[model samples]
Target chain A: MKNTFLNKKNLTWLILGVAFFFLIQLLIQVGVITPYYRVTMYWICLFAILGVSLNVIIGVTGQFSLGHAGFMSIGAYSAAVVLRSMPNLTGLFIGMAIGALISLFVSMVVAIPTLRLKGDYLAIATLGVGEIIRIVILNMKITNGASGISNIPYLISWPLMFFFVFVSIMFSANFKNSAIGRACISIKEDEIASEAMGINTTKYKVMAFMFGALIASLAGALYATTYYVIKPETFGINNSINILVIVVFGGMGSLTGSAVAAIVLGIINNVFQPLAEWRMIIYALALIVIMIFRPQGLLGTSEASLKTIFSLDTYKNALKGLIDLVTLKKFRVAAASTGKGKQR
Target chain B: MLEFLQQMINGLSIGSIYALIALGYTMVYGIIKLINFAHGDMYMIGAYVGMISVTTFKLPFVLALPATMIVTGVLGVVIERIAYRPLRKSTRVAALITAIGVSFFLQNAVSRIMGAKIYTFPPVLDNRTFMFYGLRFNTQQIAIFVTAILLMILLQVIVKKTKVGRAMRSVAVDQDAAKLMGVNVDRTISLTFAIGSSLAAAAGILVGIYYNTINPLMGFAPGLKAFVAAVFGGIGIIPGAMIGGFAIGLIETMVSGYGSTLYKDAVVYVILILVLIIKPSGLLGKNRKEKV
Candidate 1:
């Protein structure tokens, strides 16, 4: 584990991340990055966290869960409730803890009952769970019943949001790099085969769900703190689908893809605020078009690692593939003409 | 006793609409093993088309109903061709996502064109309530019940007695074998979509008339409930969908009547969870173990 973390390649990426972090801070301090841009940055970070967490379930574990927004609501509401009594940073920690705990419990509860189902059935069941959570929130007196919990404390700066984003990405990447992540990926590849290999498919699936739900809860807590308002409607099926969209757009099972897609899409969402109503339509079309043309998504199963990029290894492979395709076409033409000549 | 009977009657009326929508889900799932998420949009489109036929074109209820069905049926076929056919060999997850995208596109497009606000449906059926043995029944209720039941029976007859029906059942059983047996698999699939969409269109029109109001987003909740009903009965079974729809409608009405109306939607979801956990195969479906 220590070696993996301190490996020369990973260390380079780590140092680069720190440098980028410092650069962003310097820009913010120098007033070159405007306040509006800072808000956009916050959103991008939040979405990155969301996209990565959801990727664990949808991408790595190969389970279709539409209840992520429910977990977020749990985090946001619990955080809001905790903040109501104590308004300090410690209070925020307590809120996030409460949210994470509850979401973990909820994931376990729901997963136990519905994880036995496969494919679209599991998807619908999770969707039902999400709807149930939303409705319960809507009716709960403590949630203020649709009026929502308001005036929560906030993180107060860009660097703080960046800190959370960086931590979340690293944490998720580390988890994806671990043995447990391999177990989860095996399940995604073939649950029956994974079971045959003596992997505890059920246990791994539940753990993946719990971990994703826990992280989603944290993102929810951050969202609550950042916005200072928590509405039941805000954490509905639409939000769950939005996160799913990000995961799919990024290439399922690719952590780097999730982060990149989330950041890019987040910026696009902010820049095109006036066309917000049309955003869902566009996302839906994008999903269809992408699924039809490239089911592997924008990045496929590969990542933009430093070695591959700096060394141009991927470009070389693409050039090789192009040459192979041209040769194969010529071979086919020659074979077809030779067959015609033989017939003549 | 009288109030309970009235509630049961009301439940049956709403249940009929659910039954219509659920049949579409069942047929499509039976044939292709896909959830056809955009199906709910077919219902919404039907409502819109029915509304247009009545309010804008001055057609009678009778004319509007068939017109809506035809329009939605064609629309369903088009959707299958454009959005789903190419992804037939792809992963179910991919197809599912595409289905969602189609649903989203339809919903947003409709909302963009028609505006999101609720519009009062033009009164077509007479609203006079008649008391029979201390149970009240209205014209709209009777119409919905009779039309839904008749349509369901007609569907049963077509499926059981017609050549197209035989083709559909064969394709549903095994697409490759059906193709080898000289069945036009593509055309049969299109027919399935057409039948399902038309049924949904009927349900949409009935819902609009019953509620006397319509909106672009109207299909979302009912669509969900009908899906639950489909699962409740047995996803791939025709009669299962009908029974499930009525059971759900009854369950929902009873909950609203006896319990807090705030938790009505929650109750439906709870039932779905319980049903899924306890008997994933549903009421009428046989358990089929996964092949390793």
Candidate 2:
């Protein structure tokens, strides 16, 4: 395998990411970002990590898992247990390690049997598993049942969250470009064809699922530590759907898309926090509109790169399209009409 | 023994409502192969419509029930036309995502309009208890049971003996072939939605009268449970949905009665997973091997 980390493009992006992190840290130190907004930033990082990780299973591997919150809760609770006793950075890392191990075990057990089911059946089965996990947590004594675990010392700092999010994005992006990711993608495109090619579809699928579970667990640990209180209700089907919305809204299979969408949606949510009722209404409408108009999502599995951003041809094509729109071009109208006619 | 009998009766009553909702899920899944996650919200709309008819319009129970069914039935058709039909040629995942979006839209829209408060459904039926074979029965339970059975019978007659039923069956089997045979595939699918949604609406009204409370979010749990019933009975199989609904109802009641109530929901989900693992096609679903 090529050295993905040492490449010129990767190095430049890595430097840019660190520079951006420092800029954010500077802003926080200067009192520009309030505590409330900082919490929202934490959520954005959490969701970005979740979305990127989930994209591996649902996007790269062609598996529809609706039980992500199940793995997340396992991580949150396990980490909460450890942190409740220790309440330090070392405790946080230990808790995260423990959470990842548990999630690894659980994902293996779940993915082995459930991965055999196809499409909607898999979705429903995962949903059932997620709900079952939540219910069990709700009834557990150590988790405090429905009341949830409270007074967890807030150990997750902004830089720590940024580090985890950066790690998750890099890991998933690398996975997508690797041979195993190619095998998983082949399975997604056509399972029988991949199997004919002698790929171990089930094994790769299980691997991707385990990877997703591990990262999701890490995010869960971060979530528990950042929020100071972890509730079973926080990891319900709705939470799973919220993470799903992030992944889907960002083009599936595109790590950049997941991160972009997480940040955009996170900001939208925070901006509309006061108009809580209208916020969900608008969100639902946006989902529907996006599905109808752009089913491929925001980036459509394509990465946004510096070369593409800086290429003159890109700007020229965009300018041409804009000019066409302004000039009421007949060809554009004709093309649209023809497309509609084809639908009929 | 007497308590068991009473629980059995209670289970049957609740099971019938679940059956009504499950029929809608099974029918929609049969035609388009989409899970129609929004079907549950249709039930919630039905309950609200029924509540409004009784309280504001002062319609009697008999009249309000049909009114609710008609309104929600039409709404179902409109939703299919607007949200689902446009995505007919897209990937199944896109359609599924759209369905989830529709579900959220319905839930949030209702909550926004209705203020998310739990409205007390006016007592539309008489409240009376009677002893039957050393078991206590309430008038509302008997009424819900009887009405659900009648609706199921009516559905059976329509499906088996009517031309629209034949169209639905053929469309379910193969939409393109049915279209080639001049089946008006779109209309048939719409009709299926209408029928399924109407059944769910009737269940909603019955539930409202039974529980004496209605809310914007009340349909989520029952909708999921009914979906489990539909899958358990064999998704896309009419009879399977009915049997699955009642079976889930009975199992849930039995679990709550003998075990802890907290675990009842968990037990239902466990059953769903077990059925998916042991028999993905469900109890009555025919196992068809994948050609590819």
Candidate 3:
């Protein structure tokens, strides 16, 4: 376990990931890509982080939090406030750290009450909490009211943003594979069973929630830097729902799927920007269609295993398994309907 | 003293509307345990329908109100059929996300069709403020309060005395058992949605008249607040929802009247959080232990 991070395979993947991001940065710096494309990629990185972090809570832990955007707002404001004094790399790091700490605190505060309650109560509570956070920000003098905090220094360059995104992905993946992650999954599978097994459900639930909030705040810090503005309203229920959509669409509990969905949906958001009003309507419709047809999401619970990162056989087998599942589901649906008809 | 009475009067009117919407939320949640996020949009649609009936078709307020109720009620049924029924067996999170999706669809679709502008509701009743003693009240307030109370009483009688209502209660307790008992569970659920949505529609029209304005996105805030009200009252209980709605509405009005108007919405949310924290089952709800 101690040597795992230092192993050759892990180091190779790390290097490859860095190289891939660096190549993209080089393309942008050398004018090989449009500024718009560069911006879109930045959004992808931000959203991917958001999606993966939320997956830890909703997907892995099986808790519903409609307040990720509230945590994001906390991070955004904390980072922005810190940046007001120090607008350099040191400030960015300190700001993000501060943002993460605040988010963890807030998550703990929210979790203590709602985590003890039964089923989807947290969702409703968080929905209200998120709105409360936004409204409080609106009335606060420090947040500059509805005009929002703007014109922060751009400390999050493409490289820095990519590095943070990489860190988020790696951290989440490691967590997902670790003992604590397993505990979280067990709770999700069945909270009572896990509790009966002597698993401290509340402790793991809070930890996962705080971790998700930390990553969300980190994303928020990056969002504030990249866009150079942060508005309270932007981190409302709509934003929370958007992250939930990405998590559900990417297949909950599947980190790789979250990343993929985030990138895809981010691109879709940009492409449909011309018809601004229709974008949300289409996204909403897509959500309904996907839920109806593929409730398990595109990837379901299948995850990208690092051991099979470059294995063609693994990919083929996974694809074949997915096809089998789809056909099996179709057959079951047909048989059930016909069976009902026969009963009549 | 006069001002206090005025504020209380205002609070009751708004609270009546909240109670109406809250009933819808409570009824739907009672039956399905899913927060019909689109329920608020039903109210919004109802308001828009009322707006159309009055402005475009020149219908009277009485005619417009029922039209809005029927349209919104049917819309609720269709929404449940298309989005909710398929995902009933899935994870609660899936159903919730789908509800949010339906909400988004309704809000955006209405906005697109209506051009996203705030329309002034036509003057239905004459602006006649009657003063009794030291407190002043308007015709609109009286109409809203009277209509809201009558509707609530009617709902109470229906739910308490009717056969369909009994089926709804049975389904809420245990769906499989209800089905075994020869209840048409699906129809019962649809009927619940219909009744709830019609109440929300009534609230919407009343609010449109009181506020003298209508918009596509008007339902979002009030809808959320009404959910908070439902939770505050005891989510699955009918009377709890009514009490919760009035409490939230009064609290919001008072907060705005005495404190900062900006914190009004925040106050309602704060109430929701506090209620969940202190009493997750709400004021009227009995705490049920989850079974393994």
Clashing pairs in 2: none
Ranking by lDDT: 2, 1, 3
TM-score of each candidate structure, all chains considered together: 0.94, 0.94, 0.94
A23-80: candidate 3 lDDT, tens digit per residue: 9878988988787787888888998999999999988998888889999998889888
The positional error of residue B138 in candidate 2, measured at the CA in angstroms, is 1.7
| Superposition error at A249 for model 1 (Å) | 0.5
Tens-place lDDT digits, model 2, residues B1-292: 9889888998999999999999999999998899988988899999999999999999999899899899999999999998888777666777777888898899989999998889999999999999978999999999999999999999999999999999999999988899999999999989999998999999999999999999988888898899999999999999999999999999999899988999999899888888888898899988888767
Residue A298 in candidate 2, Cα distance off native in Å: 0.8
* Residue A155 lDDT (model 1): 59
Candidate 1 residue-wise lDDT, A1-344, digit = tens: 25655888778878998899899999989998898888888877888899999988888889988889999899989888898999877888899999989999999999987887777888988998998888988988888998999999775576667777888888888777789989988888888889999999999889888988999999998898889888999998889888888888888888878887888798888878999998988888887776665566656567768866677766675355345333433433323332321110
Give the per-residue lDDT of model 3 (tens digit) for B113-189: 98888999889977799889978989999999999999999999999999987898999999999999999999999
Lowest summed-lDDT stretch of 10 residues in model 3 chain A?
Answer: A335-344
Task: Tell me the spans in candidate 2 whose CA falls farther than 4 Å from its real position.
Answer: A312-344
Model 3 chain B poorest 10 in a row by lDDT = B86-95
Candidate 1, B242-289: lDDT as tens digits: 999999999899999888888988888888888888888889999887
